[model samples]
Target: MTSLWQARSHLFNDRTAGDYHRRLAEGLRRVRDRISRVDRPFTGITPTQLAARIGRVDLDRPLGGAAAALDELEELYLRDAVYFHHPRYLAHLNCPVAIPALLGELLLSSINSSLDTWDQSAGATFIERRLIAWTAARIGFGRGADGVFTSGGTQSNLQALLLAREEAAHVSEPRVLTGAAGHFSVQKAAKLLGLGPESVVVVETGGDRRMRTDALAAELERYGGAVIAVVATAGTTDFGTIDPLPEIADQCALSGVRLHVDAAYGCGLLVSPTRRHLLDGIERADSVTVDYHKSFFQPVSCSALITRKGGDLRHSAFHADYLNPARVAAHLPDQVNKSIQTTRRFDALKLWLTLRIMGADAVGLLFDEVVERASQTWELLADDPRFEVAARSALSTVVFRFLPDEPELADQANRYARKALSASGAAVIAGTRVDGREFLKFTLLNPETTIEDVADVLDLIAEHAARYAALILEEPHVPA
Candidate 1:
């Protein structure tokens, strides 16, 4: 007689349902325990050491069951995985996902619905379309506007630029224009579109870290009919600086240039009660990108590229008999017709569930709280004697450097401080170069992170910087 585990002909059958539930329950228990007692956000291991430890896992052999496999994962990955939910993990744009979104994840995985066509995903198609409509309305688009969920802001931007490229194909040698501090993907999109690296003309930024409309006007005139699209950043990655959208929109309108707003980072302001006004002229854009994962507290891959005119999406559509054929797709609204991706996951469900449970205002309040926290942190750092801070944050990032006695040692001290913080695993923050000098950044996305937590991290950074400075002074230089 066969064993009970081997008795089932296929997975997910009635016989295996109990086993699946058991595994899921066990996994959740482990996660709860880990989250409750996790003191460090990271394991603080060297890359080489981590690689050696992970190498011990044999992928060729079967782990026998989910219990065994999960145990191995816990040891090899979970213990070392960066936890964004932690109060001290202020490294990047990663946000702690809402509980409702996790429920959506579970439902999507269980159903495995692909939102390419109506047949493959009947209700899923309508669900995603409803979300698109909701988001487009939030952007103040007219009824003619349409959008599709994308993998992230990068893909959304690519789609927006691709549409712009197609619309401008009538003009010879059309070029893309964006702010100097715009996301790197705009340049990447230009290159990917077969426009050479030089095809993107960067407009200079002003003292306020916003796009200089005067310089933009000059460039537009210089390019004349050669400019296709003017890309405006709603929120910059490093500084969380929002470009002057109202001014940029006026310039784009006057120049007859198609405007594309990359609001991937600041799109959450749509619901943010305190800062939504910062997105003033985004409504006038011909196209826009929004990443729910970044600020909406949704899971990864929840982003959309929206366009004012529905016809603009035609550039990305392709028909095949096996998939979304033109005839069938015309009869019913198929998401694949508007997206660059086919067989896309039901990521919209996560946002849908999030909205249904938490309401949009609550989500906005969470973001508002974090932005407030960033303000508090900026105040603390600016008042502290150890840091030389930059301009006040427009969103939720604080960029500053360690103040050393010697100006020459400032860059090295900042870099060393960042490395030491990461190696110690007390907290993880980001670093960037500002005007050729290194600066540490606090990308505060976690609402749970208190001002006290930020102060402690700052203290650690100062201690580390001081130690490095002393070591550098101790080094004797040989006469050349």
Candidate 2:
């Protein structure tokens, strides 16, 4: 018994105390080396090669023993992982979080607290509650408002549609209506909530990306009670457009239908006093989805679903014998009852620490600044001779392309060029089809990125454009 106790103590003790400093120091040095090496304005690993390096080996040994097959972890996977924290990374909705949040992650995993209940989680539950309540207030949810942090926009939307699904069961199949600007996750949520792809109908909107109230009314009238709920986009991914949520809210109120706002992207601006007008009707939403990773500058895996009523989550409550013992005992709070997940990470801790170190308003200023930079870039791209800017600025992402005048060759050339461009080790931006034409996209989520960085990206795209033009010229001329 004494030997067993000693063994267990050693297992949980500082297993790497002697080497922790060394490993961290080496990693920091390597990071410094990488940062000094970059001269371009964008970077991310190629998807195909990154996929090839991904290797997982489950440590099924059961008693704190680590993987026996991870010798390649550092050399193959860790070092080559996509460097989003790089100053040049302006390619996606990903953000470089505050270092405090990263430190919070270390403390959280060490404590390993589960925020499912006020009992098991103790202080952890309060931490989550404080963050949720604070986030709700930012969205103008009144004193009694509440919410839960989820995995991502997809899961938050799943929970949003799930609430509508359980409440409006009387509505027939093919029962959901959403703006064309809404994220694809709403449709996925519909399918998971018992309505398939056929059930989710897209209501057309104008170029401004606001849902047409007339179109929504016509569809609702034609379909009658077949519609269970209506979804509006707070920030659309395609063109960084904000669909008119206030109009959709009014329509839902008139129609007596549920309103779910996929505010995953735009919700971050709630803290930004200057940019908060973009999500004018957020408080009116029956449910709202926000991603902390996008705007609040938290690590990935930090998203949330906020509802008008805290009790609305009963729609998904379930009693699992082993998973949710609190449900069986009837004396403890079960987070699984509120969310579609169990064994959830203490993601709330990072958000809490961030709010403490930097007030929500400061984060709001960051949002406003990024949007202002995007506007600055929008004008810059318009004046540049080598590129074209498409769409009005809604949030941070600016869609543009190379060789604006060569529209006839734009489509075919972009498809082939970006494919080769990413394979090389220069700048990396995304490609999007705007009004059926391909344009390079620099999605500005990083507050560290600058308008000058946008100029660097344009230079890279122009260089690639010359090469792409030569490659196209080499192809045999074909008669249309």
Candidate 3:
């Protein structure tokens, strides 16, 4: 077995430029042929059908359940199964990863490094910390800052909020003050931190989709209980709106509140010379969250929770004698201490390889390209009078709706339009209700996405809207 493994390693290491070029050609052919026309998700076939095609992947009969159950895995069930790489796929915040990052993933998986301990990871631990340090330095934390990579933005946000919870003494269910337009994960993180539903104070926002600092100040003054932290959205989930971080930072500083910035959307801009200005007040934040997957274009699961305070991860730090012995390099970081998951994958490897190859500016430029695509989308929509934009903030998500004659049916129309499109297997788009008005969202996180593609989707939207409107009119027997 050892000889076989060593031989396999040798073959893998022998992956040359020519081999990669050949593989890329195969990938391009598969993607172009299978995904070009597919706008909507493809889930018609079951896992059993897929297995049949692969000729029976035997379940419970092989190593680590490797051959286990391919009988029902639905590729379309998961967001990733859908073709995010398709030019027309303007549905989610997911980005098609850099080719090099995928290669890095392959390398790391083959090595199978467990990040929980230094004995398992060794050089990998330092690489992860180095990447964290690089990210931390950009946030102005310098020597005082430290961080840990997480599975994605959700985990990163959760970790930052937990740090705040610890600061709040875990007493009386600490309250979290956040913008009304904050990411869904903020409330989830609050709940996970034991803040509960009642503890979350969804503060009103200013014109920029940021929580009004004045409103937060008022909430702080009136609230009797200890405020755990003020969570600001550096990049909102839906509208891509950036909260007023500087102003929020001032409030948190004055009120002695821990400020956690969820910059998962906008963090990539920190590397952009042109757009880094969006994160002005992030320096004042006690902790900040960033997702390398979204705009950084690393892969599916590269996220980090960074802090200006070195010991902020205290709450997450574990004390298993078997895992963490104080005698073993008191400064050594065991991944188990800072992350929510144990037996975590070596996600940092791709990130390390990414930053190493692309450099920070190249990575930042990738985000810059996406932002530019978003601007182009704005221009595309501006030309058409049939569509009404809900809002177009600085980040990638653009919310708009078709204007039907009956405003009353606007919500239903918006929801159904998206449903009909996805059901047809033609294209996939995102939808959300804004101020009771349902709207379709164009979330452009992919750098490969073009203005023409967005235009194509908008045209499809108009066509779908008209079709649905005609249906509403024709189905006279049913109440509108």
Worst 10 residues of 2 by lDDT: 61-70
Q: Give a tens-digit lDDT track for model 3, residues 1-480.
A: 346754453343445546545554564565555555464554434457655654654544443321122213323223226677666667888887887788788778768888888988989888888888888889888697888888877888888887877777746757788889988888887777667788889899865666787888899887745788888888787788888778888878788888888888899888996999889989888898988888778777888889898787777887888988988748776777877777777888897778778887888887888888887787777777887885676878888888877666666667777876775656678988788668889888777777877877777777777777777888844322
Q: Where does model 2 exceed 4 Å of error?
A: 1-10, 14-74, 321-332, 404-406, 477-480
Best by TM-score: 1
For every candidate in turn, the CA RMSD to the true structure comes to 2.5, 4.2, 5.1
lDDT of 2 at 398: 86
Which of the two, 1 or 3, has more lDDT? 1
Error of 3 at 347 (Å): 0.8
lDDT of each: 0.89, 0.75, 0.77
Best by lDDT: 1
Cα lDDT tens digits for candidate 2, 88-116: 56677887777768767867876788766
Candidate 2 TM-score over all chains jointly = 0.87
| Clashing residue pairs in candidate 1 (N, C-alpha, C atoms within 3 angstroms) | none
Could you tell me every candidate's TM-score relative to the true structure? 0.96, 0.87, 0.85
- For model 1, how does the per-residue alpha-carbon lDDT over 384-425 read when each residue is reduced to its tens digit? 888988767678889988898877788888898888899899
